[model samples]
Target: MDQEKPKSSALSEKSGVEQPEIVSKIAAGHIVALRNKNVAAADLISGILSGNITALSRAITLVESTNPEHLAKANEVINGCLPHANQSIRIGITGVPGVGKSTFIEAFGKHLTGIGKKVAVLAVDPSSTISHGSILGDKTRMEELVKDQNAFIRPSPSGETLGGVARKTRETITLCEAFGFDTIVIETVGVGQSETAVHSMVDFFLLLKISGAGDELQGIKRGIMEMADAIVINKADGDNIKKARLAKTEFNRALHLFPAKKSGWTPKVSTCSAITKDGIDEVWEMISEFLELTKSNHYFGEKRREQNQYWMLETIDERLKNHFYNDKNTIALLEQNKKAVQNNEISPFAAAQILLENYFKFNH
Candidate 1:
């Protein structure tokens, strides 16, 4: 009886038997399709609305992707999520290098999380002139908030974009909103037109400044000043307190020169020490007031509508330019036209017209 004991499956090697293939536990209709990016757009949307961080991050990557397949998928996700967006408060923070934009965001973000508010920081880092690579090293600077469970920091690179904002920032905002982040803070790459770009997409625009950095007016452009909804003087601790106050007064005076805003809200100027965490709450309070005021006036909704239209036109313009430059025939024509124009055989406008005609013809 012991010698005739039934052998285990492995011991019965001589038996001719086939085992059924095992499927993955996680492999569902749409879940499996996610592996190949063939999942229906609604599934991705559902995942995001359910607060799945992985799905949210993946959707953002898709939104920023240049791959054709990912681009289509990204568009699907965006369209699906659009109805759920615009529920978050979007703040655009911009400052020149060394004004502690990173520090301020860190402290501000921590303050928000402390109050049980979910925060998302979209920090844009400057690309290196030599390597053309961005450090995207903001997380190191924002140590506390980076660790907070309610905080999500996404540092992106400013890749040759004139406005100091990433190309996909507006799209990224939508994804963050859908992820249930009630507050969004966008830190711009640099101090110039980046503010303008950020201003277009956000509900509030805050400009950070440092005292005694230079002639305060010279440090920020008049146009930039006009666009700011609030200006905060950072590093206002130790010996810089008096200087910061002076800068605050000077900024207030300059702000008065601009015509009144349509929102009927006067811009605010304050001083904050991000290191000591002083005046951070005051800044948030000001923002909350602005949101309340704008909401009451119905300007908040109107501004978002205007921004949507602006981005739509901007996207179309970008696509048209990309299409013209990416076409091989267009490139060839451009080279030939460059030579002709340099030799004075044809005017620049004439060469442009010829290239445009050919581009449209080929596409059509």
Candidate 2:
């Protein structure tokens, strides 16, 4: 018995994996909560701290949710995760419909995953101009890439914003980064002039286009070209080779006309075929080189800080709008004042003042 006891003690000493105290305690509490199928705020926080992707996704859904209770809990999770955020690269890709943005993204995402990089393809699809429902289904287009274990694809339905801004997308990117995703790609279904929202959020904006058509010069909206940090002519395969070549030249000229978006690093045009997977490496390399150059020149971090400020102001505007719309009395007053002005019963200036007074009275 004594010999057996010493042998057991020796075995325990050899395998002295103490499993760090903090980790064990957190896990023990989380396990109990999860086993009961009730993920509390603490469980969510601990899960996020350990970089559990599922927990992060669930937390984000809560944040994106409209339920008041969920909003409260989600805010807590966001606050807890805030300290661990902002480490990943934010890349925004925008192109008009039929530009092969999804195909290009699938190829690019697969390549990144193959190289041990985790890629999150966060997309904003254009909503119906009237009903405001998301039209382009980016997840359906990036099917193969969605199956990749290392790739996370989130398609955000565009809301009533003038642009297809998800409103929660910037928050989503920070959450993805906190979960250790190194590459964050935001795909905006280029719609009208509103697609400029992508430019304010990313380190670089990539404009994807199909190269073979002579329509290349007219295909991309002028504002997109102006905001683009790089243009990738996609589908450069098969019989499109010659046309792709010509299109590249056309874009090269077009790009030269635009003012430099990022200082010191001129935007370049590249070609790729998402089907054949040609030029994918070149595209990735160009991005890395551009990032290095911009970061070295100190524009990368500067741009991000400016973007952060933009989001703060944007949030303020959103909350103010909500404050107005959510007040039942304000809505009634707005209608009354609008009708009074429309009927000329009250002077336009007087109606405006009444609306403002009512808004402040309700708000204060």
TM-score of each: 0.86, 0.83
**lDDT: which candidate is best?**
1
Where is the poorest 10-residue window by lDDT in model 2? 5-14
Model 1: lDDT of residue 329: 81
Best by TM-score: 1
Report lDDT (Cα) of residue 172, candidate 2: 84
Please write out the lDDT profile of model 1 over residues 1-364, one tens digit for every residue: 5578765785554558775658656666667676666556777799999998878877777787766567777888998888888889999999889999999999999999999899999998887768989888999999888899999999888877766688898999998998899999999986477887889999999989899986676855678878889999999999999999999899888888889999888998999999999999999999999999999999999999999999999899877887789898898889999999999999999998999899989999
> How would you encode candidate 2's per-residue C-alpha lDDT over 238-298 as one tens digit per residue?
9998888888888888877776665578888988899999999998898899889988999
lDDT of 2 at 141: 86
Estimate the TM-score for candidate 1: 0.86
